[model samples]
Target: MKINFTHKLKILHPFFYVVALCFLSTKAEEDNTDLRFATQPTHQTAVLGSTVVLPCRVIPRDGTVQWTRDGFGLGTIRRLDGFDRYSMIGSNEEGDFSLKISPVTLEDDSEYQCQVSSKKGPKLRSRVARLTVFVPPESPSISPSPEVSATAGVNVTIKCESIGGRPAPELSLRFL
Candidate 1:
């Protein structure tokens, strides 16, 4: 048995063409959705009653951009709901919309999302920013009086007081 050269070429031509078409289609789809977002201070951590900035940067501007809190619609950081302690710190045409939170509290720690959209449906980009509010350890205080007197090798109690915080302080016994 023998195979015809012309018949073999015809069989392979269609398969090769189909592969090329698929590659082009995928590339086009990716190009259309190139807008993306990123953040600075990737991990947002701050103390209560302190201000924090949530920076947002994007690539290629084609439409308006908006800020959100954990996926909820936040027209602007300054005007966001449940944002009494938050505000807009900075915004520019260069895709920089940073959120500012003033007098932050422990209740404000949560996941946040920033969304960017264009007139064309193909240009919708979003980025997530995680906020962590930590209450700094309070200034240690000495109880039962600020100073304690003890004899050599004698048991003495030096108590330190703290409030509005967590993680009980580790009492270290040291003689000075």
Candidate 2:
């Protein structure tokens, strides 16, 4: 027994259509590219009342860049909520997507992300960077010294301590 050519074509019509569709969909280079994060944001440390910039760069340089703080809502970084301390620091001309936090305070310490999305291609993203803001210790409270009275020849002892300081702390002693 033999099969007709027309009957064979009818059976394979769906298979041919699928192959053609896949080829057409993947034929455009404008839809996707080698765009990716060239440099990921790294951990940064800043002293209180200072500024810090998190570095980020994309390869293609055509994608739009954005930054998001961890505590804020995940939708977008636009909602200031009376705290617009963060802002973008780079432009398309420089091909940088860094985030700048000025006058760094204890509240500015958090995690941040750099996201890049292609205008005519796919989306790319970078790893998160942590900002650590260091604040100086406040004045200490000395007990018993203010209430006790000492004579000119008598020796007096006092207690002093500084807490909440970072990166090797130091304390000074003075006699009045």
Please give the CA lDDT of all the candidate structures. Answer: 0.67, 0.73
Clash count, candidate 2: 0
Per-residue lDDT of model 2, residues 95-141, tens digit only: 77667777898877888887776787766667878888788776676
RMSD per candidate (Å) reads: 6.1, 6.6
lDDT at 164, model 1: 56
For every model shown, the clashing-pair count is 1, 0
Span of ten consecutive residues with least summed lDDT in model 1: 166-175
Tens digit of per-residue lDDT, candidate 1, span 40-75:
336667777888887767665556666666667767
The local lDDT score (0 to 100) that residue 144 gets in candidate 1 is 74
The pairs that clash in candidate 2 are none
